[model samples]
Each structure stands twice: as C-alpha cells, then as structure tokens.
Target chain A: MATSADHAAPAILNEVNPPELPRAVLVENNRSFTWITDKICGIIEGKTPAWWWVCFIVACFVASFTVAGITYLVATGVGVWGHANPVNWAWDIVNFVFWIGIGHAGTLISAILCLLRQKWRTSINRAAEAMTIFAVVCAGIFPVFHVGRVWFAWYLFPIPNSNYVWQNFRSPLEWDVFAVSTYGTVSVLFWYVGLIPDLATLRDRFMAAGNKLRATIYGFFAMGWRGSNRHWSNYEMAYLILAGISTPLVLSVHTIVSFDFAVSLIPGWHTTIFPPYFVAGAIFSGFGMVLTLMLPLRAIYKLEDLITQYHIDCMCKITLATGTMVGYAYAMEFFIAWYGANPYEGFAFINRAFGPYAWAYWTMITCNVITPQFFWFKKVRQNTALVWILSIFVNVGMWFERFVIIVTSLARDFLPSSWGYYSPSIVEIFTFFGTFGVFSVLFLLFIRFLPIMPMAELKAVTPQADVHGGENHH
Target chain B: MAAQPHGLIATFETAPEVYHAAEKVRDAGYKFWDCITPFPIHGLDKAMGVKRSNVPKFSLTGGIIGFCTGMSMIWFMNAFDYPLVVGGKPYFSPMFAFPVSYELTILFCAFATIGGMFFLNRLPMHYHPVLKHDTIHRGMDDQFFIVIETRDPKFDAARTRALLEKAGGKDIKELEA
Candidate 1:
C-alpha cells in the first residue's frame, strides 16, 4: 500500500507544482551600476524641474497656514479649537498620533527591512526616511503648540529647577518626550550617515562637470569620503549597528505612544492589546502614506525601473497585512468590550459604532479595513492608480480611526448628564491641514536638493555591483 | 609646485580582481596599503587582512552609560529631588524607567557608532594623497583601486608595479601627496 501510494504521489506532485514564473528583478531595465548612479544623481545635478517648483510653491503656500494657524491660536488661545470640557484631547492629539504613525513606515523600511536583508528597501528607503524626519517634525509641532504656552515646553524635560519641581518620569507623556526626541535625533544621524557616500558621489559628478560651487557644497557634507576600504569597513559596521539600534525604536516609539492612551483609565483607551494594535495601525497608515508619495513621484521622475512594480506590489501586500491586523484589533476591541461586560467599555464600543460619531467610526472601518482588502487580488495590487487611490482612503480611514477613538470615548462618559458632542472648529481644521503643507514643503525641498535615492545603495544592488555574486562580471 | 609622489595606485575592473590583488598584496606582507571601491566588497576585508572594527564595542560602552544615566536621572529627579506622588505609583519604578532607558541606549549607541566610525577611519581629513590622482575619482563611481603606499615596508617601485600588473590591475598611476 505504501509503494502504491508512493507511485501515486508523483502524479499529485506534478498537479500541485505550479509553472515556473520568471524571477522578477528588483531593479528593472537591467540598469548597469554606472547607469544607476548617473541617473539618480542626475536628478540633483540637473536644473530643478518646473513641476518641482510648482509643487514646492503649492507646498509652501499650504505650509504658511501652519504659521497662520499657530499665530491665531497663540493670539487667542486653545479655545480657538473645539477642546471643550470633556474633549480636551481632540484634533491636536488625533493629528499628533496620525503623523507619528505615518513616520513609523520610514524607519520600518530603513531599519527593520534592512535587518531582514530586503534589498527592495534600497529604492524607497531614502525618500521614506526623509518622510519619517518630516513627519516627526510635523508630529512634534502639535504637542508643542498644544501646551498653550510653548515657552514652558522645557518643563516637559527633566531639567533641574531652582524652585525644586521635577517632571514625573512615571508619566507616559514624559516618556513620549524622550522617545520622540531620541527617535528624531537617531533618524537624522542615520540618514546623514547613509547620505555621506552618496554626497561624495554627487561631489565627484559636479566636480567632473566643472561646477566648483556645487562640488564644494556637496564635498562639505560628504565628509571627504574617498571610499577607502578602511573607511568602508568602519562605515559598514556603524551602519549595521545603527540599523540594529533603530529596529527596537521602530517598535518601541509607537508602543510608548500607545502607552499614553493605554495607561489611561478611560474605558476604550485602557487595554493590554493597545501596543501591538497601535504598532500595526502605525505601519499600516505609514505604508499608505509612502504609497501615496512614491506612486506619483515614481511616475513623474520616470523611476519605473528603480521603483518597480515588484516593490509597489510588496508594499501593497504589507499594507494589506497591517490593515488586516488593524481590522482584527478593531474586532478584538469590540469583542473584549462585550466579553468584559463593563458598562463604560461596552457603551464606548457601541457608541463608536451606533452613537453620534458613527459616521467617523464607519468611515475608519471602510477606508482602512475595507479598502486594503481589495489588495488581496493580484490585479488590484499591480494597478498603481487603484493602489494610490486606495492608499488615500487608508490615510483618511486612519485619521478617522484616531478621531473615533479620541472623540467618541470622550463625547459620552459614564454619566449621561456629562455627555456632549464634539466637532473641530475652523482653526482646528486648518491647523491639521497645515501640517500636511509643512510635511509637503519639507519633503519637496528634500527631493529637490538631496539625492532622493541612495545612489551608492542602488548601485550596490545592481547585478554587476555584487561583490560576492560575480556571475555578472565583465 | 609638484606634490611629493606618495605611492603607486592600481585600478581593477572588477571586485574579485581587486580582492585577488588585495590578497596578493596582503600575503606579500605590505603594510600602509589600501583598497578603494565604490561600495564595500564582501571578503575584501579578509583579503586586505583588515581587523574587526571596535565600533560595536564603543557602541556597547555608550549604551551601558546611557542605561545607567537613564536610571540615575529618573531616580534622582522623581524620587530623590521631589517625591511627588501621582496615581500612587512607586517613586523609583523600574517599569517607568525602562522607556527613557531604552531611548537613551539607542541614542547613545547611534552617536557612538558614527563617532567610532569617523575616529577609526581617521575621517574629516579633507586632503588625502590619493585625491591628487585624477583617475581616483572613479573609485566613487564604478572602479576598484589598490594603492600600496610608498611608506609600506615592502614598497619597491618595480616590485609593487610588477605585483599589481600580475594581479590584473590596469591604469597604474604614481599619485602625489
């Protein structure tokens, strides 16, 4: 019988084994190492494109509203927004969480995927890391202005005071100050270190072009990198160490952010699962933002071969996976609320779905949970336009998720008499929109001046550039 | 004025070619020699007989300092200086101390890594003897180079040139300091 089954197994195996598909190249167009560097570096070396200026102008115009909003808020007070008695933490906190969550994908690509040896990250990591820095900057702006008096913001730090008052280290808010600042600092350092060799490339290219001014400027930032083996050895080690240290931060920064809500005694906010949920949600929304940025830029820059369909597909799958995790967390939250039989928690979940903020809650569900599920189809994953559109939906959905979480929880408390409706005032709306402007302006400037892709890294991944794999050797 | 001739620089078309040349040069017991490439070549360090970098060790030391600093700062500030109790949590809670400690560890480790890299490589030394060679610019592009310094103990011009030529090196140039 065993022999008979063995004889039958070949037939079954033949049926199960799919036809061999041609392996996809991460860098498309069979681009040579020299071509990779020349093409990517050319973007910075050439005159700034007119569209870049147009986009930059628009971004600057939008970003100016941040100044306007902050001025209005300062001149008046926090009262300009809809932070009433119960809903003290409304749009400001919501936008803060949203932007911070958006920042996570950058580090996730640069650090985590790097550790995993995912070479696909090389194409997108530079831009994504820049996005991370800008997003964190946008994220930082909210909490500072939310303090009502920005000058006293130093009180958040544990600097010794003459009056003998110290910040409470036990508070998650204080932990946020440390976590976010450290994150920002480490990200900038990591980005600059990665940029050095590429900057040197730019310097050499400009020097060859007889542009001494550009060469001098780039050379200053390049730190005189000569690509010496001695330098390469130390540089590689430092980069690896930075990648190792950054990995924990990718998880912890958002976990600590979740702790700000989880440590609270509020019915919906207090949960053990908040950390993982927030992290998954962060990566989910982050990939959404990355897709939104990369899709258009890839088309405009004609970087199709570098930022290939393979990369976009993989990113879509990640968004789908993280979105599914977010959906599961939403379900778990509801299930736990019901299972625990706590009136406040149960009422909070129900109110989020059926009460006054039902529209926001359902919008979050539709955009984040439902939209990404479309990516399960191969065709949908491959379609850039559709993916871009869906990514926008995910962004909108994530914002609503935060809105629903903060507002719905606070809108109706334990006592029915204390229940109140919450809505953002025009100032609050403009302030939130202004952050996008700031983020865009910074990102636009980065793309204009800097090597948006890591030329060295992109070269490293090309076929002929492989040190160990010499099959492509000329 | 013409700069002093520092050494002979030999260019290789491929990584393996350079790796083999580095091995030959290293086996010949040449010190004060260096390989330059557009990117870090795997096994090239072994070929060049390069020692393991102490950057990680510096990072570890920095991380340890950071952990201690984080713990002590929290303890001294919250517990020792002004013991204000909110939410009835412990004054010196290790649980509360961990996030700041973790962030500081990463922060210190990152700083130390970059600092150690620069220190170990003797970087920010804008001028180098090799930079005077025009062909050396390709080292930042798609070329490989091995320069056996004139300061090397085994630096005979004829022997070094012969060794590099035998190792498939092309475009051998005598660079000035």
Candidate 2:
C-alpha cells in the first residue's frame, strides 16, 4: 500500500511538440497503480450493497414484462401490437431503431475513440462497450419477435434449412439482419478481448485472497495470461485490428439500419440523406446515453478522479457536434422535399411537422436539437444535474425522431382508405419499456461480476507508465 | 529434485527499469526470455527486439474466405441452387451482395484475429512453471518482471542472475514453473 507520493522523485515531464505544454492527467491525484487496482476490484469483491439488491430485484421484475409480453404475443399473435394495415411498422420498428441507435455509442467509444487515440475513453469504454452488447441484446428482441414467429427468426440467417429458403439479399431487411448480428458478434469479441488483462488481475487477486472458486473461474478465462510481452505483442495487434474493423463496422451498421427506410418507397423514410443523418443521430443519442449511465455510476462509485470533468466536457462536446448534425439533417430533409417538387414527399414532410403526429415531431425537435445546444454553454456541460437531465432528453428525442419518421409516413399513405393514426398497444408499450429493465439487469450483473473499467488500459495512460517519462526513470 | 530450475526471474519497480533490463537481456543474447508487466509498456517491444505480430495474416485469410463465402453462397442459392426471381432483377448482383459480404468479412476477420491471437500466444496453457512462483501475480499488477528461461542457450544460473542485477532488477530468484 505504498502511496504515489512515496517515490515522488519530481514528476516526469512529458515531451511534447511545443516542449512544455501542460496536459490534464488522465488519472487524477497521481494515484498509484495499486490504488487503481484496489479501487476497481473493490466493487466486485466488496459486500454487495443493499441498493444493488433493490435495483437488481426491480430490474428483474421489469424484465419479466418483456418475458410476459413475448409469451402473450406468441400465444395471441402479432395482433397484440397496435399495428394495422398502413402503420404496420409502428412502435415495433421505432423501438427497434431506438435500441439499435443506443448500441452505436459503445462501439464509438471503444473502436472510434481508440482509433482517434482519445486516451480518456479508457475510463468509460468498458461500461460503454457493455452497454453496446446489452443494448444490442435488447434491440434483437423487437425484430425477432416482430417477425410474427420468434422461432422462425433463425430464417434471418443464411443457414441451410429443410425448405432451402434463402434470405432476400436485395432486401434492406436482410442486410439489417447481417449488419446487426455482425455488429453484436464483433462487439462481444472486442469487449471480451479487452477484458482478458483485467480478468487475469482479478484471477490473481482472488487466488491471493484464497477465493479459489472465483479465482478458478476467472483463471479459466484469463487463459494463463502472465502479462508476458510476447503475448502482448499479438494481443495489442489484435486489439488494433479489432478497432480498425469496428470503426468501419459501426458506421456501416447504422447506415444499413437507415437503408431499411431509405431503400423504401415511403416518402419520409426514403431519402438519400438517411445514411449520414442516421449515423449522426446514433452517435448523438449514444453519447447522451454514455453520459446518462456514467454520471450515476461515477457518483455512486466515487470515481470522480478516473472519470474526471475533462472526460465529461469531451463527451458533451461530441454530443453537441452530433446533435447539430442531426438538426441539420432534419432541416435538409424538409428542404429536399420542398426543392425536389415531389408532392407526396413534400406532403410527407409537411405532415410530419404539421400533421397528426406533430406532437411527436416537435417533441423530437425540442429534445434532440434544443437539448444539445445547452452543451454549448460551459455551465451546462459542467453541471452534472443538468447534463443528466438533458441526456435523457436526447434519448427521448431520438426515439421520437424514429417514431415520427415511421408513423407519419404510414399514417397517411398515398390512399385515404389506407390512412390511419398509429398508437401502441399496452403490450407494445410494456415491451419497449421492458427493454430498459433487461438492459439494466444485464448491466447490473456485469458490474457485480466483472471489472467495469479496464484497469490495465487505464494504467497505460498514466504518465508513470511511459518509460521515458518523468525525471525519476529508475 | 530442486524442481529443475525453470528460469531466473527479477522484479523491477517501474517500466523504465524493465525497459532497460530487457535491452540488457537482449544484448546479453538471451532468446527464450520475456518481460511481464501489469500493462504493455510503450516501446518495450523494440527494447525486447520483438517483431510485429502475424495476426493480420490470419485476419486477411478469414476475410477473403468470408467474402467468397458470401458471394458464392448468394450466387449458388439465388442464381444456381434454387433459381428464382422476385423484383425483376438479375439473379446475382455484387451490388446487392456487398452488404452481406462486407458483414461476413468483418465477422470472420474478427473471429480470425481473436483465434489467431490465442493460437499464437499458446493461451489456455493452464499450467506454467512461472505461475509456481509465489510472487508472480505481482507481474500482473504494478510490478515488472523479466524471466529468462532455462531453455535459452545462453541461460546459466550465475551469469543470468548477474546480468539481471546489472540491469537494475531487484529480488532476483531462480524457480521452475
């Protein structure tokens, strides 16, 4: 338990381009390496708090709603949803898109940030990546169940079957199946690979503490990792390649998701701008979610030093940048509709903002557009309370954005006979709400059983880790 | 009877100590040696004379197979195996096949990358003489360690220990894994 100050030997001055520019210490308080390990591992090894029990219990209860809703849907059929002739997509599609969009932020932090060399991502990437996996899990439920029969959802894959029915390669829905599944699988590999070093540390700690059961479990996964440099040589390359592939993969996933609409004939959904717009919106909402989840956990764990306000500021700025892009996309959509002179298309955009679903459209505009603008002010970004509340708005707005796009177009299709207002059935509402519970339950378990932060990765960022760094090289 | 003396291990307090120690070991002509640390110390690979990993080769091979699989799978199914038409379009078009191919490429590439890493690292080894060292866990924590194996041609108990001591390594110990 030696303090960092024990060997202070004047802080190592990092070499910079301008020679002596200052940078924020990624880990605050000059915390020692042992402190970092003890702090992170403490969460899992320490007694499970009462509040965790309450939260876990509630999450399970909430998750049951999904289980119940799916069971009923299977028994009664897809008719249990409020989907009708024209608005067949309805909340199922909306909720699916919503959950999928949330998954992007995790990959963005892990892959995109790693590629960009954003060092601060180390503190939050583990949790964000976990969120990505669980969000995808929640997202997978909607489309699978919406296919009218959950059992036949396997049909989405290109596996051989008795009927020899192949998926329609031409259909965007088919592309979505490939894109999402690939995204989910790669994300798990990336997440698990990142966990190995930290897992080995936990295994060693458990063994030292005489917790053979936990140690054996963690050790099996650690794969006899002794932190050997030879192993690290390959491990680092694998990580870099994963990040490289994932960067393109994350962008492609949402673009393909957007293709589900853009490739369609629906006026609002069919836009050349959907790809970049959807990607931007996904990043925007994803950062909002990262903020939402991190703020609470940071507070609860007292991880202020690791998370730091600098990280918060950086996150807020990205949200602002992406949020602005989304707003621009919204405006451009209208401009394209007007400028193109397609009456149906023009009518669709006009109907979206001024039609029956105007409430949802306006709500989206306020939450997605106006909410992020607050981040422009340093006051807002720095205020944890304000940032948390606004992060919720960002997610709410993104959900509505999907809903507005789906519902408004279908609610007033080309024929008046087919036109009808869309609303969710109680089952649909609960099913969508239940996903949050499902996500929370998985996330809670992850925190309880695993290292929520990448300890080894974080240690790498500290100045002390630099061999040529600091005055005390010895 | 003495557990066959697997190798000599030495502890260093910091990355710099290990980095320099690795250089000394490399210069001293040890081949079956490695530096174990809590994390990858930047530039330690160069110090240890380690080359870039060959994981990308496996990743590329997997990607190529995946792409061919996606392309041929669709061509065989829609164009050859079943032979049906839906949207009055050609039976096979790479334009439409690109997404699935691209996804499969990434999927298989990832699988290969992870699999290659594990295969190359000889992981899940479960037992190693190094793990027998009571204080070896420290290598996965804050401390840095250099272990020159008994298998190394240059390995000699007295000489290796002296070389490590000269490189600023402390608490040098000889143990069998």
Candidate 3:
C-alpha cells in the first residue's frame, strides 16, 4: 500500500502547472472539530451578551409602533395611509415587495447554494434561512392589512365556502397568497430539518450540565436523532429533495410577486423583463441584508475563524453581480420603453427619471447601481465597515426601487386629472419602521436561543471531519 | 421481547474507523446494530448495508396529487362554478393555472418529504436505550460509535465486545436498556 506522502509526490510532479487553488480559506486558522461545536454551542450555553439584550429591547420598543399603527389603521380605515385616487398603492405595497425581496437571499443561500455544492454557504445558510422566514412574516403583514379588513384575509385562500364566490384564478393577487404562504412554510421546514442535528448537540450539552428542562426542550425538537445510518440516509435525501424543490420555488416566489404588478396594463408595470429583473433585485437586496446582519454578528461573536474573510468576499461578489443585473434591468426597462414607441410607456420612463418622484428614481440608481460597483475593487469588498455601510445603502436603494415602481407609475396614469403627488402618512412610516423591529426581535431571540450557525454543518466542511480521507494534519 | 440488561457500545475517534467497524459488524451478520456520530458521515449507509431512502417517491406521489387538486380547483372554480370574464381570456386557461399548480406541487412535496422522514425514522420516540448510555453524549460531539443491540441473534456479549475491539473500537461498554 502506497503511503499518502508517496502518492502526493508523483501527483505534484506529474502536473505541468497545477492550477494554484484559490488561496481562500473556508474556515480560517485551522479550527479543530471540537472547537467548531464549542464556539457555536457556546453562544447558546454561555452568558447573554449585554449588546444583545439592548438590541432586543430596542427592537421590541420599535415593534410596538407596528401594533399601534395597525390598530389605528384598522380603526380609522385605509384612508389613514394617504392612499388617494391614483397613488393608492403607496408605501404599503412598496414595503411588502422590499421585505419579500429581502427573503430571497436566505433561500438562495440554503437551497440554491446547497445544490450548486458551494460549501461556504454552510456557515451562513442557517441564519439566512431564519431571516427568510421572519422577512416573509413581515412581508405577509402588509398585503393582509392592505385589503382594509384584515380579518377577511382568509378569503384569499381558495376554500370551499357557503358564499360560493370563487377567487379569480387569473389574478396575480391569488397567486401571491399561494406563493408567499408556500415560501414561508417550505423555508421553516428546511430551517428546522437542518437544525435537528444541532438541536441534538444542544440536547446532549444541556443534559450533561444537569439542565433537565433545557435538555427536554432540545430533545423534543431533535426527534430522538441517534445519528443512525438509516435515519441519516433519509435525512440527507430529504434535505437534497428540499434543496431541489426550494431553488425553483424561491425564484417563482419573487416572480409571482412581480406578476402582481407586471400582469397589469400599467405602462411601466407591464413588461416582459419583470420576472428576471425582480429575481435579480431580490437576490441583490437579500445579500445586502445578509451583509448587514452578518458583519456585526461576526464582530460580536468573534467568529472570524468560522465565518471568515472568504465568505464575506464571496457574498460581496454576489452582491456586485446581482446589483449589476438589477442595473441592467433598470436600463433595459428604459430602453424597451423608448424603443417600443408607446407614448404612455415612453412617458412613464421619462417621468420616472425627471418627474415628481425623480428623487427616488435617482436614489435607487445611486444606492443600487452606483454603490455596489465599488465592490469591483478588492479593497472595498474586504473592508467590513465599508461593506456594512454599502449594504445599508443597497437596502435603502431597494426600498426606493419598489417605491419608484409602485408610486411613480400610479401617481400619474392615463388620466391627467387623477395625477397627484403622494407621500406616506406618519402611520405608514411607523408601520414600516415597526417591521424592522419585528425582524430584529425575531433575529435577536433566534441568535440567543437557537444555534445561530449550523454547528453540525460547519464541522462537516472542516478537513479533520472528512469521512473518506484520514484527518489532514495541517 | 423483554428489555435486555445491556448492549455493547463501541467508540471510535474518527468517522472512517467507525464506518469500517459498521461494515465489519454487518458482514458478521449482526441484524440489530447501528452507528452514531456527531454528523452524517458520508457513505455510511453503504458501510451499514442500508438501502436507499424512498422519501422522493412519496414526494412525487404528493406532487401528483397536488397537481391534480390544483388543476381541478382552478378549472371548477373559474369555468364551472361561476364564470366571470374580466379580461376576455378563457375561463380555464392552463397557462393561468400553472402558478397555483406550481405552488401546490412544492407545498405538497415539502410536506411529504418531512412526513416520510419522520415516519421512516419512527421519530419523536423520546426514550431510547442508546440515549441512556453515558458515552452516547459524545456521539453528538466529536466521537463516532457503533452499538449492537442485545436483541440481535448473534448477540453473545463477550464475543461481540471482542469483535468490536478487533475492529479498532475504543472504550467498549455494556449499555443498560
């Protein structure tokens, strides 16, 4: 039997120029197998950080405004939102699209990256998936109340009822109910299925420390996972199938959401480019949100070894790519509008860039198009503070993109008399801020209670944990 | 069958060593044996002589049902129940039905996969004999283990321990049922 050293010498010598494998480290500083579990599980087991409590409390306080705003809106009616004759789909719809777009990154990381065999996603996928679930929740809240009678939201589903009034199958609104709900349900199951092994790890850790209650709680979720080969076989297969299912589902979700506008006869809204354009924008905003959350998290948790520079760099590249795609879509929308020679469509394009809401149009251009181009330089991508700040710019820019799309198109339609400037009421502004609070509270609790990083998955990617090969001494 | 007093547990430092031992145990004709590890060690199923999972088949079945349901619901609601033309398009257009059908297919498939996993694993069985073993905790950490049940036909305690030790297993123990 040839020793590994003996085999390595010939392979190294045989190649004319062995491609220099990209020097990026997946897990930095050669972390040990036990170190992976300890560092990750330690976050859950160890004392709560003071900053976490501060963030959580602040998030909850801000989230209270959402409750108050919703209460007032329900009491006073949708008229409180500044929705008038033409600009009726202001702030609420824009926020809905923005949040739903934010969720795409999570599914993109977990399902799409998993299928593509991108090992780096293992570090961030769990948290990203959790973010998807919470973001969808925030997104779902808007359209439900946008109907004015929130209680009658159940009518959105195609249930057999005594009223005998069936939902329009051709309506994009009906498709949205299915798309958003299905996306939410699948995201949760994927997150939980991935969490089971790590939950078992937590169960054992808590049990060892004589914390019976915590053990019981974790154990219940773990579903008595004994790591049997039989169970693992099914688990892996199920995970793969889910990844397969979710990849297209994620794309479809945003596409269906896009159809809510694109299917309409409105000049700016009706375009063939909306699906790909929306999907790219969704990924762009999603990565921005990931960067916003992860940069601070990596600093706070001191998880530089696990969530390394390479992960951040890869994410930056993705943001750049998706941002470029979004920019292309923006350009294409204008180009097609002009080339098609339709006066309403051509006017819509001109109005967007130079009309009443031109400020928002330019903001979207600066933040989404211009800011991310800075990432083409390695220096900008590697700079954590710059990346984090730029991510916030992308977030703001994406919100504006939706704003420009919804309000500008509606504010000035076919009839000149209905044309009016629209601005969000205080209630609408508060509700939007409140969603940020809702997302933060869920995220803070998630980081505190659950294994934020998938401990088992992180371990699987390390050299020492490889099953086929012997441990790499390096 | 009555609960056994003890079953043999063998611990290995690495996944490959335990995987080999699992293969050895399977080749030795042990029926009631299983391996445990911190994570799912790749190719462990082949080593344990386990068959491929049928979860995908169940998912497909679910997807077919969902497709049928989606098509039927849309057609019945729009065309048959009470047709109301808004855009002068066909009431039961397949193109219009595609989105709802796609969503339902994914929804049903996801539910089926999860359900199949749970059913196959006989899960939510909170109490297991292996859970009681002291060294079982390490299975969730860094250690790899193979346990042969007392209920197995070839379960002579002394011989089973000797076989495990020969296969490079460490810290072999008699776990109480």
Number of the candidate with higher lDDT, 2 or 3: 2
Model 3 spans > 4 angstroms off: A1-19, A470-474, B1-6
* Local error of candidate 1 at residue A339 (angstroms): 1.0
Go through the candidates in order and give each one's DockQ. 0.72, 0.81, 0.78
TM-score of 2: 0.96
Determine which window of 10 residues in candidate 2 chain B has minimal summed lDDT: B1-10
Q: Considering every candidate listed, which one attains the maximal DockQ?
A: 2
Q: What lDDT tens digits, residue by residue, belong to model 1 across residues A225-246?
A: 9999989999998998899999
TM-score to native of every candidate shown: 0.95, 0.96, 0.96
Specify the CAPRI tier of model 3: medium
In candidate 2 chain A, where is summed lDDT lowest over 10 consecutive residues? Answer: A9-18
Clashing pairs in 2: A12-A470, A12-A471, B6-B176, B129-B177, B130-B177
Candidate 1 residue pairs in backbone clash:
none
For candidate 3, the share of real interface contacts preserved is 0.79
